[model samples]
Target: MNNRLLTAVFIAAALYLSGGFTHIAGAEDGVTFIPKESEIVSAATGKSISVKSTCPSGKRLIGGGGECTGYLNTLGSAALTINAPRPDEGAWLVECTNLNRNPGEIRAMAWAVCADAGVLEKNR
Candidate 1:
């Protein structure tokens, strides 16, 4: 029930509600969501780390998110400074800083939600 967990839950719920992980029924717009995940990175106290999830070829990034997990620090848990889509790079970037002063590890992962470029064009 920490900040990081709450943030992750919130993101998951939002994605579920928005159908970011499912195909729409009877919709033949050729729009589909492809999810990608980065390898987990662990950071020590007072350290920072960054990770990215890149979409496969022919896919463009639409949305993304990240997660941080570990023991809480004196102030709080690790902070997510960036959780955004990198359309130019066709990826999702995630950065986190470990504010914990004690001895522990903070792990982070990046998630990318991608779709056909044609879908993006249609929406635009």
Candidate 2:
């Protein structure tokens, strides 16, 4: 009886957690996915990408065909994650690997969402 109850508990927990799993519908994300501009970039591979303060502020490229191409090829898919930094402000963390070619320059004003948010509005 105890074993059966334990199994039921485990199943309940799994279902509860899995129920919250989210799927981004209709979002197109190629390798090295950056959903918005001005997001911090990954300095290294196989690790959590971060926000780099060094990114230029005046609407310029962030990561240009940099070393990211090395890791992008290793990944089959990537996610463009957004973290809220402040109220009405957020930053992106992206991981990219060039499957066929080198990564081009990066900028905070690169995505339509960034323009709508007014973070990269001036560049638009």
**Top model by TM-score, which number?**
1
Candidates' C-alpha lDDT:
0.62, 0.28
Q: Tens digits of per-residue lDDT for model 1 on 2-118?
A: 466756875675455345656331125543444344344456676777778887887666666776655533346688777777888988887778776654556567776666656
Worst 10 residues of 1 by lDDT: 23-32
**How many pairs of residues collide in model 1?**
0
lDDT of 2 by residue, 62-90 (tens): 12111122233245222223322221233
**RMSD, model 1, all Cα superposed?**
5.3
RMSD of each: 5.3, 15.8
Clashes of each: 0, 7
Candidate 2: C-alpha lDDT: 0.28
Backbone clash tally (model 2): 7
TM per candidate: 0.63, 0.20
